[model samples]
Target: MELPVRCFVKAVRRCFLSYICLAVFCGCLMGIALIQMIDGSFKMDIFERKQNVTKPRTTTLETPVHISPLRMKELAAKRANKTDLKQKWLNERIERLNKAAQKVQMRREVTARPVEPSDKFHIFYYAWYENVQYDGNWQHWNHEYLKNWRKLDTKVYPTGKHEPPDDIGSNFYPSLGCYSSRDPITIDIHMKQIRDAGVGVLIVSWYPPGLSDGAGRSSDLIFSDLLNAANRHKLKVAPHIEPYNGRNPVNFLTHLKYFVRSYGNHPALYKVKKNGKESTVYYIYDSYRTPASSWKELLSPKGNISIRGSAQDGVFLGLLVDVHHKHEIKRAHFDGFYTYFASNGFSYGSTWKNWKTLSVYAHKNGLLFSPSIGPGYIDTRVRPWNSGNTRHRRRGKYYDVGWRTAISAGADFFSITSFNEWHEGTQIEPAIPKSTNGYTYMDYEPEGPNFYLNLTNWWVNEVLNKTVHF
Candidate 1:
């Protein structure tokens, strides 16, 4: 009986030990699950906080990792600082522009002299040549006349096998030779020559910023120097705005604003007074490129973006290429019209006989008529196929005829075709008699180099002395 009781006690003890081991294993599993839940909740909180503080990063099927709150704060601070700096810089620029405009107004009020209508003789000026500064690239000098000499179909070679600064690609050669517009001495000499010739204004050829003719440098690159030289010589400067790529009404408005803000402050900038109000004058080359409707947007007094009668208002002269262009100019609300071509019969407006009629029409319409005169026209070197347009100098007879016609028509304003357009053989700047390896250049031979200059002085004095009704 005692042995059986001892066996039962041992069995009961074994069963109780197994139950305790099972309890310990279950407790370990529950603890691991609780820890995992707490970790997941903490990660979710962090992601929520990041989303609230910063811009959400793009995410795909893969979950995004949350950036720390400290890092997000740093990024926000950096962006704020950058924005502040940009705003401050813009403000400073605006302030500077305003100050410049004010100074210009004050100076003009104190010292500006009125230019008489009869004394106004404007000249077409070019600033597109290069020299050693361009490293012998022969920029507009070689390329403008003949893009590829090998492909040229002319009977005569343009340059005559001689390079620039000696024998260039022109029917006539300059006394100063192939010169760079960038040279300070050259600029000074040019200013002196024009002033001595009795020219009152220099209508400088200009293109938009970063734009230029084929192989030519931007005209704006030398504009500051030109203005400085003109100021020193007591000559006024006006922009001959050229048509550029992508030009339209919108961009043109921007360009005008930029022009006013940039060079309008210069003392040499040209201005005209009407009814006791002084305004700048701008010559728009190829103004017909933009439709009259587009121009009305900026020129009409009541149109949007209109500068007319505003602080930026000025006399806008459109190119007179055809008789019908006068109607177009009037429809576009242009202030005046000017003939630019040197060749008298090249265009309807350039015809000498039409000057008096046009001048009469202009006066009736309250528009100014400015006739352009040239000594001659010989662009065979540039346009070999178009020789019909060449007009001989006739030893100054042609020029005298043009001047007489303009004066007889009662023109109050006059513009010379060019001061130094060697490529077109219309330069009034002195030209020396030059001959090269196989070519001969035209010049004011019987007279001296200063013959044209003397003639110009005489004509200018005559024009000023006459009574001009405008």
Candidate 2:
């Protein structure tokens, strides 16, 4: 049992090392077991430190629960109330709409579906400038003409009412309550279309003729054919006069005297007489340029002419009402305003409603409201926006707003901006086919027969019979 001291020490060291290694192995196994107990599974000792070494258990965050719908309804009921005036207003409007719908239904029952293009609808053509002068002939290009017009002698509609498109007539065709000069043949063609469409009148775009050397003159040739055609067609002719363009009181009275004397007896001539006298409607295009005082003076004795022939004058001034510059509308003293529409610009969408509200105020003040409808908007190109979208949707929902707004405004009449303003691509004229946003030629889907025919008829029906409110 006895050994050298060095050997005894070495043996003791070996025993100590063995005992330490056994204790370390047992400790690792226990740690792994503990980790498995917590995790509900077993893993190698290498992963035991990662699992069993957790500092603490986490507490889950509580989620808030919503109240029941029954409680919400009770709360809402306690606060809910509607004003009598608002309720009455809504009811009256609904009643009006219902009556309008019923009337439309009745009309459909009575009048056969418009099978003829001419019979379908009527639109003011000259305002859009789709009619151009070519070789002493005024050539018209419109959306309807472009999409459906055939080069044949007679343009036929589904209803088979074939009327040769005149394309030639007088130079001065009445339009949009005014008169403008074009080739005689062009005017004739335009008039024929109006007649075919069953349009009741042509609001001639008129201005006194200016001299070759910037001097004032008695009249323009534009009025010559308008009066003649209007007389012949038994269509009402209303001449819009402007006194500011050297149309002073004397000249105005002279022109009025001439117009009334020459065409007064014609069946188509408009004579709005009240209190035993012929009334004149001087639709001033630029009311601000020519003040109300000018109008007053023109109708007065000092400006020239005798008051003897002067009778009841119901002057209706037309101007584009800018809501931002509403002061212009208020200051102009217009009997009514002719508001314009651009489907794309700032005036599109919700702004249309604001214009409608303004229209209501104008109507309440005895002003006749006339608003414009165009193919689309191009004002952004003319007056570029500093920021945001410079372009707009031309064909889709954009164009619909103007059409719907015009109806909703209970518009006195709808003035389609152009039958042919092709540069902006809003022409309803044939021979010109181009599509720009909001100003596309035909923005309809099935693009051939049904769209154009139905559209024309719809516009015609709305203008002739329907009533709308915003």
Candidate with best TM-score: 1
CA lDDT, every model vs. true structure: 0.81, 0.47
lDDT (tens digit, per residue) of candidate 2 on 232-258: 655566555544446555566666666
Which residue pairs overlap in candidate 1's backbone?
A: none
How many collisions per candidate? 0, 32
Mark the regions of model 2 whose C-alpha exceeds 4 Å error after superposition.
1-185, 196-198, 211-219, 231-234, 241-258, 261-264, 271-280, 299-314, 323-333, 341-351, 377-399, 421-426, 434-454, 463-470
- Per lDDT, the best of the predicted structures is 1
Report the C-alpha displacement of residue 180, candidate 1, in angstroms: 0.7
TM for every model, in the order presented, reads 0.70, 0.50
Query: Root-mean-square deviation of each candidate, in angstroms?
Result: 27.2, 14.5
Tens digits of per-residue lDDT for model 1 on 118-212? 23899999998776554455755663444434455536534333356665767887787777888888899988878877888999998878988
